[model samples]
Structures are given as C-alpha cells and as structure tokens.
Target: MKVQAGELLQKINYPSDLKQLKEEDLKQLSQELRQYIIDIVSVNGGHFGASLGVVELTVALHYVLNTPYDQLVWDVGHQAYGHKILTGRRDVFDTNRLFGGISGFPKRSESEYDTFGVGHSSTSISAALGMAVASHYKGETDRQHVAVIGDGSMTAGLAFEALNHAGIENSNLLVILNDNNMAIDPNVGALKEYLTDISTSKHYNRFRDDIAKVLAKISEIGPDAYKLAQKFEKSIKGTLLKRSNFFEALKFRYFGPIDGHDVEHLARVLKDLRDIPGPKLLHCITVKGKGYSLAEKDQTKWHAPGLFDKITGEIKKTVYEKPQPPKYQDVFGHTIIELAEVNPKIMGITPAMPSGSSLNMMMKAMPNRAFDVGIAEQHAVTFSAGLATQGMLPFCNIYSSFMQRAYDQVIHDVAIQNLNVVFCLDRAGIAGADGATHHGAYDLAYMRCIPNMTVSAPMNEEELRNLMYTAQQDNMGPFVIRYPRGNGVMVDWQRPMKAIPVGKGRKVCDGEDVAILSIGTIGNEVVKALNELNAEGYSPAHYDMRFVKPIDEDLLHEVFGKFKKVITVEDGCIQGGMGSAVLEFMADNNYRAQVVRLGIPDTVVEHGEQPELWAECGYNAKSIAQQVRLIGLTRSMQTIAS
Candidate 1:
C-alpha cells in the first residue's frame, strides 16, 4: 500500500494527537508505522531490526504515557524511529539518516518529545533518574519519567550503577528493560541467563500480584501493620526469587517479564505502572527483527539490514568495478584469527560490537579466544588488562567514540602498567549519519594524552594491515591503530601485507610551493586535493603522517623548510588533533610558517553523509584546493609587498 500524504499518520502530529487514537485503532496504526519504517529504511538504510523490535513498545508507550511532558528517554536511541514518526516526523521519514535530514537516533534539538539526546548505550537510566529527581525537586510529582533500555545495554555497569543510585534515592522513574535476547549477536554472560529465568517463569506474575494484594490489605490495618507488611513482602520476595535480585537489590520495584509484541498487554501494564511509582523496572520480552521472517531467523544480519528487496527479504549485493579489499574491521578480524591460530596466547575482545568491529569472524574462528563483552566498554578494557597479565595478546576492538567510556581504564589499567595490549580503535574519525555522539573525532586527543600509549592511524588498507602486524609484533607498551569506518581506498588485498615502521610517516605527493600534512583515512582526500591544486597551476606537497604520537621531527623540519605555507588536514577536531600537533611542533622549534588547519570544528558536528561531512569540514578536494589557492594568492601579494 502506497503511503498517502495526510492520511492515518498525517492527522496525528504529536503524542497528544496519538492519545485521541482508539485502543483498537492502534493495531492498524502500528502496522502503518512498521510499513512506513520499512518504506523509509528500504531506500535510506539504517538500524532496521532495532526499530522493528520496538514497534509495539513504541506504540504502547506513546498510547499510555503523555509524552513531551512525561519524559521518555531511549537508551542508544537507534530504536527511536517509531517515536520520531509518531511525534510529527512521519512526512520526513524518507530523508532519515541522510545529510540534512532526520537523525538515525534521538536528538534533543530535533523534537521536544526526544527528552534526552542518546547515541551511546546505557545512558537512559541515569538521564531518566536525573529528570525524575529534578521533577521531584521542582514539585512536579504528576509528571512521569520512563527509560526504555535494551537488554544489550543493561549489560553495561552504568545501568547497574544508575539502578543502584535510583533505588536508594527512591526516585520516581520507570525503567523499561526491552529484552530481545540479542545485542547485535546473542547476548552472552550470566545476565542473559537471569533474564531468561525471569521471562520463562510462569507463576512469577501471579505470585507478585498476590504479594502486592497482601501488602495492600495489611496497609489498610494501619501504620504498625504497614511496617510489618513491608518487611514480610521483602522477605517473601527474597525467598521466592532466590537469585541475585538484580533490579530490586538496586532498590527498583521490579515488574513484569511482559510480552513486548502484544500492544494491548503492554498498554495495560504501562498504564498500571503509571499509577504506581518510585524507580520501577518493567522487563518486556521482545524479539529482535520481530515481524519479518528472514530477520527473525537471522537477527544479527537483520540488525542493520542493507538495501534489500522488501518483497523477497533478500539484500541486493552491489558489484564494484574491482572487488575491493574488505573493511579495516574485516582485516583486523582476519588478522586476529591468523594470530590466534598460530599463538594460543592471543585473545580477542569487543564491547557488544561484534558485527560492527568484525570480531564475529575471530569469534567463529577461535571461540575460546574471542569474546563479545556486551555494551561494557570499561569492563572490556579492564578485562583485556587482566588477560595481558596472564600472558595473553589481547586485541581489544572498540569504536573510538565508545572508548570514551573506558578512558580512565585505558589510563589506569593498561597505560599505567604499560601492558602490551592492542587497542584496535575502529571508526576513529567522522562516522557519517550516526552524527556527533558516534563520530570518532576526539580519539586522537584522548589517546594521545595517555602515557605509554602509541597512537597510529593508517592511510590505507595495506597500511592498516601493516600497522596491525606491527602492533602484535611489538611487545613494548599498549599500541592503538586507529582506522576509519567503511572500505579503505579499495586496495588489492592479494598483495602481501608489509609491516609499516612504527611512529613513521611517508610522503605521498611531492611538490614545492606548499605542503599538505594529512593523517588517517583522509589521506586519499588530501591526495585528490593536491591533484586539484596541480590542475589549478600549483603543485602542493602531500605527506600522510600515519602516526599521531611520536612527532616526525625530520619530516616536519623538511616540509617547513621547503614550503612557507603548510596546511594540515585530519577527520578529527582541530584542537589537540594532527593539525594541533604540527602547530605545537612548529612553535617548539620556533619555525614561523603560514599554517592552516583543516579539520572538524571544536563544536559538535551533526548527522550527515561521510563525503558530505568531509566537504563540510573543508577536507574534500575542491574545498582543500580553494584554501590552497587562497593562501597562494595571499603569498604572491606578500612577495610583491616585500
């Protein structure tokens, strides 16, 4: 059915509009919403399964809760598409995840209904509790606060910490644990088992209700009876559960292992919970990729379904001119597999990003050696450090942005000990569409500051492979080889990989008029810019300064002497980035040259396409050439003045 403009979704602009919807009408509305999401994502690809899994939950929440006023914070906001569509963004769904369009995740500025901006996982509970506490302080006791967090996210320590704090404070907060039994891949560890026990327990709800009713009856017997009833209820719950009362121990009133797909059931439960309060946790069981058959069968692949034939549920594989080398993550995955194959001491670790980090390949190849430590970035770092002490070459793969969670761990555990752990920092630059929270802009800045840490970024796939080999070989201190997301330069992998010299850079394009010092995956862009400059009757020297840490003094002095005008480009913040390093070096040496820094601005960059981000940051060929030409013209004027 073609989506008609101003039909079912058009009439409903906000949560208030949704409240007018009949309970029976919500089933059709959910269908429309799912189809709309499918239609939008079919063209503009994004997190498909996540949104699909939360379709009924999204509908139920909006139907029951008064949104915008009743704060609903979504942890790792990738699943907030249905929320966005329901809250006045259905018409613009076509432009989802595109440059200058609707974000893939919730943004505070985009909609008032999006109470908290979230991209990183396990933040909803803390944020929701903060809001709930604020509301209490302000004496807005009627306002409801709900946190919708995935089972995957619940694995993070921060969630547990928030639960602990909220429980103690007795904050008026509702935490909805959306358990899909999958976090990118099947969620591992003891928590998954605990959740399974909760979901499958048949008499749990009946027992909980009976206990609550008994407590209510006792409360009617007056103040003395109420105190005795509370003690009896706590003892009974403790004896019946017998397990580590995870949420309740943290002080949250645990409710449900409810059916997430059944919208009516979810609505009834949410409504009941709305009446009762004080740090409540609703555990709703959902299936990842709920509706679609293929997605249901293979949830991991469907997690972020690519452009596919909606009818057939088959992804369309596009063929390139020359079959390119796999992504940097794939190379890392394969490299680790090879290393693990040879050395039994090697262990691989990823923080719930098995697919994204390409650690699945390693996990499959060496099951015992590889681990998907779910959404626990801090834990992953410390875990690797423990492995390091036990004579294991622990290759910890995590997205650069996520590594922010373990900044203290990286410093305290790994760096301080000078452990020989390999930190494979993937997406260490402007990760397009996912936006500011996802962007790996500050990795260089953050990683560079850590003592006994060697930070290296590869210019191409070969260099990335080489760097990985070097990192494994060097049993010195902790080494981090940062690589950007997506395929690297489409280089030939058939060629034998060679190890790059550590803390060294190589000249890519030779010129005399000006020098362009470039870093990371942006080297290709810099090369293109230099080519454009040549076309415009100028020859600009280009150097791919692969390593950010150990300043290449010889290369810096040579480039500074050769060209009076120098421009530094990186896909990171200009402050404390590659450009800043160069500027600091020049200052230390007292070398005065006209320096231009091209990078992501100090402020947060919004969601957009990778190429669009590059263009916006003046890292694209045309933009870089324009800056060079401007500088050249100014130099010519200066020469004439002299």
Candidate 2:
C-alpha cells in the first residue's frame, strides 16, 4: 500500500528543505510527518509510539538548527524516525528495520545528521557534550550541539554524570529533556517524581518564561547587571519554587516545562536557547504517542507494536493453528511468580524492562518483591546483589545485550562475593529486527569466563522452569540462565518444574557415525537436522549440554569414546561459546576427533528475522543439515581412498 505524505511534509526532503518552511507551517509539517511515520510503520513495522511523540520537536529542531554541521544526538534513537524522514531518508523510510534496510536507531553511518549512533538509553547527553567540547576546541563557536534525551533515559547515572561535567564546561550544548515519562515501560525512580513535581508546579511554570525574559534582558545590558540578574533569578526561583533547582545547582541554565506539542513555541524557544547557551536544558513535556489515540492510552503496548491497522488500531499477530508455545521471557515471567509463591526468598528485578522481559507479571502479582529500576543496568545488578546478601534470592532479569552495561557489577558485587543472585538473561541469541546493537550474542562467552559464575542456557520452556528453580536453591552462587527470544517448540510448555543436576548433559537420541553437542534452544535446530540426516541415511547422535561453565565432561568423554566425528552447535559466538567449550574439553582430555563448530562467526551480524540470521550465520536447521551432508561426503571419500 502506497501512503502519501501530507502536502507540507511531501515538500520536506531534508532539514534544509524544512528550514525553507515558515514557522507557522511547522505544525502542519509535524502532523504530516507523524502520519507518515504511522502509515509506514503500520504497514512495515518498527518502533511506533516514540517517533510519534517527538514529531513537533523533530520539526522544531531541524527548522531552527543548521543540522549536519550542528550536532543532534538522539538518546535511545527510538524517537529518531521523524528526524530520519526529514533528513534525506523519507523515500526509503518504508525499508526501516528490514534485513538489509535502515536501522531502527540513529546510526552515524546512515546520515551526517545522525551525529552519534545510539541503541542503549542515557548516552546522548555525554555524547553531545563531547561533540560540543570538540567544536569549541576547533574554533567552531557558532556550532550548536544538542542531545534530545527522554525522561526515562534521564534516570540513568551516566546522564547525571554528563550533566555534572557539562555544567562546568563553556560549550554550546543544549540538553532537551524529552519528558514523556516513559522508557519502553513507565518511568520509575526519584527522577520521574522530581520532573513531575517541576512540571506540575503552577506558580513555577507560569512565572518561569516571564522571569527568564527579564533575566535575559538584564544579562544582555552589562556585566554588573548579569551578576545582579543571576542573584535576582535565584532568589525569585527559591521563593516561588521552594526548592534548589537540580540542573541550576549543577551550574546549567535550565529552561521550560513547556508544551512540546506546540511546534511554534518550541521553535521559538529553541531559537532563543541557541543564542544564550553555555550548557542549558529545555524540559519539554510531551505525550509519548501524541496523535494516535490507542497508542497514547497504552504507550508501552504501542512502543514497538508490530504491523498494526492505522485506522482501527489493531496490532497484527501471527495466527497459529494449534496452541503455540509462549515466549521465553513470558515463561520466565510466569515461572518466577510460581517459584516465588513457594520460595519466599525469590524476588524479581529488571532495569526498566518490566514489559520487554515480561517481569510485569510478577510486578503485578507481587508488587513489593519485583522492581523496575529505571534504565540503570549497573544499579540493577548491584541492587540484586544487595537483595541476595539479605538471604533473598533475586532473579535480576536483564536483556542479554543490556547485561554488557552491568558486567563490572556482576563480577564485583555478585560473582566476587559469590552472592546467591540468579541472573535471568532474556533475548540471549539474535534478537530479530532490532539489529546488532540489541542482539544477545556474547553472554554465553562472557558469562563463562567469570569465576564462580554458573553460566547455563535452557533448551525449552520446561528446562527454563527447571533452571529458574535450580538457581534459587540453597548456596547456588551467581547463577546465569540465558535464553533466546520468541517461542519454544513445544505446544504444551507448562510442565511441572523439577531440579536438574548441575553440569549434566542429556542425550536426545542415539546414533552411529557422528555426535552433535549443543547448548540452549539452538539444540532444537540440531534436532531438526538429525531427522533430515537420518532420512538421508547419515546417522548422528545428539546431546544437549545445558551448562556452559561446569560442562558435562563425562558426557563429552562418552561421545569421544563412541564416535570419531563431532559437531558442536550454539546460538552464541563461535569464538568463545559452547562450541569453544566442547573443543576445550576435547583438547584437555587428549581425545582425537574431527570437530566442526557451528555458531555465529567473528563478524558483526546485522538485523533480520531469526531464521534469516541463523541461516546467514550457518547454524539454522537447513545449514545444520548441509553441514552433516558435507561431513558424510568427506567420510565416504576417506573410506573409498583407504
């Protein structure tokens, strides 16, 4: 379906084109841009609500600033859709987040306007400050560096650290705090409340613009007047607001808790701030899903709602013939509740991923036990460690890629102390569509290297339950259970949980010629390959090595004794994952065998469907079957030569 952009938006091919438009016409342009995003995303899905929320701000920024030359850094890049469409990417906007298509986030390589690439939240402030400092050093005094970060992202310590440093620097940096009160899930922590208090204060907001106007007028006249104006403004703010301004205390000149949806006002405010800025902040309060009614109502659901009906507001879902298996995160969400019901010690914690990690289920059921710790991955790890120290088994559910941020915390706070913290790493493999930044590719490799960290992955939902149960058991120190995104193979997946023996391998089937060792859900691909290979008269045994750290040495020895041919498979990196563990075992035992490792190669794999990526990485079912055929052919040639 061909969706036409509104007349004003159709004229905008670049920010230069946007600059050509009159300030009065920006509102219409914002509306059209928002609609275009809705239309393109409705047919070809990517991130939804975030882009809609920032439509006016996007228009205002481009209209006021000389972009490409002037830096604009989007925090998480979830809200960069409008920026992309305006900056010479409108024609190809339909291909967003596809296999070889454009990224969902703001990528530096994608366009000159995208000053910094971002996927993780709370990075824009620091990144833009650095750019601002560089511009100052290069004698580019006229150049402006802006970071548009959301309130949810503002909760992170990195944003605060940058704010502290930026306050002292004499750089042309403007931090636009996009206060939507959201970050995938609703924003939590004291920061959210502080922003809310400022936005809600009637006296503070009403007199703010008037006071700023007077201060600006007074400051412009003379140096003595500027000093008097600073003292005067501080006294007035203290009297009216009855609080020390957070940003102002850090030495930043703070402005606005204004209506971000008002395009004209925003454009004018942005123009004013461009001149007076050393290090200043604009607090723009905007709805996350401004125009869309359904999206505005349930912001989280519509965050990245896959292919929805633009008019009716019905989100598209795959229709399965029979009862399908639940997502691994869903299994974790529900099973954690089940376990917590029995074990009083078990608690759930996720770093602003209650919905994404499916920990919302527990949060709803046991509110006190489960926590949404804003976007602080590092804090979440240490918080879980604190809970563990109190004899409470905390299941710190973080996305595998996000876990990279908390590596030091995991090692220092949990693993070093041997704390009884269960780390539930969701999205443990190639997270489809979101791209390389979001892919959970390194957890298996990274986790295994940490001493006292018992790294493991589940083969199915039943195993996930069992693993979750096992991790909370007495004296289980810093357990890590990594699982992939999407559904398990079993239709009826709600099996009763039972503790499996640690470091044990389970044989899936018996065969003659070759043995296949796999860990986690990738083992299912090996199972599918075994069936096809069996039909082709190539017999191969299958074993699932669930735990990666304390690997099943006995099972590996049995396989080495039985077969001369071995193939190891995993969903993680080929270099240091389960396949590498198998090879290490083979070398340690001095067992001679022809081994082939099948997993993600040492290269950056881009965004695609899980099947497409697996096939591309040469670890999918078809790829596994092809590998078996090649091995069989080689064995036959050797026998014939002999």
Candidate 3:
C-alpha cells in the first residue's frame, strides 16, 4: 500500500507486471496513471479528458484480467492512452501522434494488449462478442472477453444489435459500459436520460429484487393466481423501473451503476464478474474529465486542449502578429446560423459532433432547428432524410470517416429518394492525430459512386461559403461539400455569399507547359507550386476542379487539347477520386496525354502533422513542384520527337 505509483508503473511493461502489485497499491497507481496522462497530453496534446476519466478502470482491468490472452477491447481508443503507456509503450509515449510515431488510437499491430483496433465508437461490444463466440467454438470456454464501451457509444444501433445477438448466443462476455454521459460533446437523447435514472436509482433495484422474491411465492402457493401476478408484476415494473427494466429483458445479467473511479471496487467487481457465465453488462458510472479540476469544469474544450499547462490548466496559444483565419468548422458553424436565419426550412444535424463540427453555434442560436442525434450515425442519416421529406433542407454535418457508418442509409433513404439533404463533410482529408482509422480519405470515392450525389470540395474559405450558399438553393438531389481539418487559408473569408455555377472550374494561373488539375483544399498546395514554378520559369496551368461529380468537362477538354501533359492532385484516395475521375474522362474522350495522378496511395497513413503526411503522400507544395518539373521535361521530349 505504501508503494509509489510512479515506481510501480515504471516496472509495469505489461499487465502481468501490474498484476504483481498488491490490491491496495492500485489506488496510488491510478493517481500516477492519471497524472502521467495529463503530463504527456499537456505538451503532446492528443485526447486528454477521456484517458484521464478511465484511469482507474484501465488500471483495474489490466490488473484483474489475464490480458494478451484474455481479450480486452476499448470501444473508442481515445481512452486508451494510459493503456498504451502501461503496455510496453512508456518510452515512446512522448512521440504520440508525432510524425512516424505510433497511432493515437489502439492498433492491433501496435500491441497484443490492444485486442482489436478501434477509433469510431460503439464497436467494442460487437468485436468482443465475436471474439467470445470464437473462443466458444475453439473450445476455450473459460477465456474471458471484455468490451469497455462508453455511455455515448451505447446510443448507436450496432451496440443494441450486438447485445441482442449476444443474449441469444449466451456467450461469456463482459460489457463494461463506461457511463460517463459524454462522447466528444455532452451526450443527447433518451438513452442518456435512461442511464442517468439507472445510475441514480440504487434503492429501486434492491426493492425490485425483494419484490420479485415475494412475487415468486405466488407460483408455489397457487398456479392460477401466479399467472395474473406475473403479468401485473411485469407491467408495474415496466412503469416503475423503465431504466434497469430494458437490459434485463435483453437477457443480460445487469450489475452496478457503481462508482467507476473506485479502483478497488472496480477490481473486485470485475473479478467477481469474471467467474459469472453468459452475457453480462457492468454499468460503471464515471466523470469524463475526473482528475483535473479545469478539465472537469470544461470537458469539451478540455477533451483535447492543445499544449496546455498541466499545473495552471491554461492552454498555450500562438500569439499571431496578424489576423488568423478561423477553422473551417467555425466558418460552417457561423454560416449555418446565418443561412438558417434567412431560410425557415434550413436545419442542422450532427451525430455526436455538435461541438466538433461547430453546429453547437446553431444549436445555441436555434435550438429547435439544430439537433445532436447522439453516436447513432445510421439514425442521424435517416433522421435527416425524414426532415428532408417534410420540405426541410437539413445540413447533415458528419465527419467524413463517421459518414461511412451511415453509407447504407445515405444510399437507401436519401440518395435513392433524391432528397435535398446537404452533407457538410468536416475533416474530409487526413485528420491528424486520430490516424488512419479517422482519415477521411475515401469519402470522395464512395460518395461519387452514388447516383444522385453531387460532390465538391472548396479550395479556400471563400469558396466554402459560396458553395454552402449555392447548395441551399433549389437542387435536384443530395449535395456534398467536403473541407479539410484546421484553419482555412483566407484571412477575410466572410465575403458576400454568391452562388457558384455547378460543374464549372476557374483557371488560377495559365501556362504554356503542363496543366495541373487539383480538387478540394489540396488545390492550395497546387497554387503554391504554381507560384514557385513561375519563379523558376516553369508555367504549369493551374485549375481548381471544384466539382468532382459533374466534373468541369469543358475545362478538361481545353486542357487536354492544349497541353499534352497533365498532373492531377487531391487530398482523397487516388483509387476513385479526382485523379481517377480525370483518367476516366481522358479515356472516354480518347485524348492521348501523359496523365500523372498524385494523391494518397493505397496505404494507411499513420499519426502525424498534416504537412508531413501531405509531403509523404507527394501532394505538398514542394513535392508538387518536383512532379511538375518532371512533367515539363517529359512533355518537352514529346514535342522534340514531333
């Protein structure tokens, strides 16, 4: 008990090392573990609040479970920073989310302790259930499988589907619902309300158990009376304990609404549950940002405070000499409010990212118009479709990676119906720190293939405003506007909103040499490359192909006929993105030109700064210039031969 957490944790490279310590020592371990995460995240700056909240739970799970052998799956890996530190990643913890560093999320390739790779929420229950079933089939009946899911994640349909199937299978799996009542933003919906009722109503559970025992005696006394008594008991309990009432009906042996922060209690409860068979769920109540006072005060901002002072809790911000452009999300946030004020039918909807997508601004301005639909992506998509059916134009703001979860809904409900739902895909490119699991690299490929979808990406903040303004007008079908993470390039972005003609692109810098066609914010790099190429006397014509779906065919024909060498760049995948779009167009038109496609390759990009990742992908300004130089020389050779 007197052992220091810092000292104990230093020796802990694995769960077996953690298990060597006495049970009383876990309290100190949890403290040190919380401080450790705060210390690292203060300067390093990845996910802060979630990891701090789950310190005790992480310590208890690793100490109790035979991890690496017995499976442990974290729902969203935002809470697994501490798990990484304890599991042989202590030295490299400082390198978290840095260029060439380990992934921010739990990756199976990174560690044996991380049983499954997870980034998007609500997947742990399904993955853990699958593992438990696999264990059962393999005759490893006693192998313990656990899935630690957040309360916010439980709102998703996938969680319920897995819970339903797990009940039928009767697998020995433990689902630790880390009921923090939050995800990125504060949780929404009836599930949060129900969980709160369950967490608070301890006496109701005891009373229900006592009453159930008393009611069972009616069957022993008289069979005919017992039938009526069962119906009455079920009906009354359904009305009385509606919260704890649902899980028991799902065939899960429910326990807790217990203090998740209590390390000893958690360890003991987990040990007890380890011996119990069939599908089990332990509801552990916890605070989102528990340890740090400032973090606990403002959970959303504290969730990922960039380079904050751990002691004073003051965030470090760059003292810019000039006015800096606002984040693309902030632009969307303010723009949505402005657009909604003019149009009565305009509404905003985000899955669980009201704050992240800056839709919280709309929520604050028009609470009825903007909605946070929880971590249910599929539900959010269908809900938007429902709104669209009522002549309401819904701006469905979902992160590009998260949009994949609701692809089927987007196709079946919205796209097929030709509903005028606007998809504002925030973080449509490489989302830094969150890694490959979160990179919005495939949205263009997927969205473009859908029949009634118009895909577009803005080069700067001005274009974003204009396109958003244009899409709100009477349109044929679903429209997608994708922009990158971080700040936009334009300092004065809020210009007068004007409608941009669909499927048309404007040439930025004209040249007699190679033609460069770029899409989205990635075109910013092309502009830089063109400027640099001009200084070097290499004139590569620059064109921002605004619309990826109904591509600027007029511009493409002009470029191919005039210049034989073309270079296409995009932030999305090279497979079926803007580059592929250009290739298909050239093939269809029978244009003989040397086309070089530059974009994200068919490889998972690791956690890194955007610049470094962009450079590595060969889409940065410097890399683009190099490619342009090679293209200029290749075309010169072709001209000489002619």
**Candidate number with greatest lDDT:** 2
**Model 3 residue 594 lDDT?**
87
Where does candidate 2 stray beyond 4 Å?
215-220
Clashing pairs in 2: none
Q: Write the residue-wise lDDT of candidate 1 on 1-642 in tens digits.
A: 344533566777787888888888777777778877887777678888889999999999999988889999999987898999999888787778889888888988898998999999999999999999999999999999999999989999999888878887756799999998887888888899898887776656557656555543554577687667657767766776657568877777776677788887778777777755577888888888877778889998998877887888878778889767688888887777776776677899999989899999988877888999888999999999999998888999999999999999999999999998999999989898898899999988888878898888888877877787777774757998899888777656634567777778988878867899988988888878777778778878899999888868789989987788999988888899889999898999888999999998888888897899888887787788888899889877988999
Rank all candidate structures by their lDDT, best first, as comma-separated numbers: 2, 3, 1
As a TM-score, model 3 comes out at 0.94
Model 1: lDDT to the true structure = 0.84
TM-score of each: 0.94, 0.98, 0.94
TM-score of 2: 0.98
What is the TM-score of candidate 1? 0.94
lDDT of 2 by residue, 1-642 (tens): 667889988888988888888889988888899999999999999999999999999999999999989899999999999999999989888889998899888898889888998999999999999999999999999999999999999989899999999999999999999999998999998889888989999988888887667655664687677777778878877777767889999999888889999999999888877768599988999999899999999999999999989999988898978888888989999899999999999899999999999999999999999999999999999999999889999999999999999999999999999999999999998998998899999999999999998999989989999999898899999999999999887778888889989899799999887898899999999988888899989998999999998998889889999998888999999889998888888898899999999988999888889999999999999998888788889889988999
Pick by lDDT: 1 or 2, better one: 2
Local accuracy by lDDT, each model: 0.84, 0.91, 0.88
Q: How much is the lDDT of residue 282 in candidate 1?
A: 82
RMSD of each: 2.4, 1.2, 4.3
Q: Which tens-of-lDDT digit does each residue in 589-624 have in candidate 3?
A: 999998889999999888788888899898999999
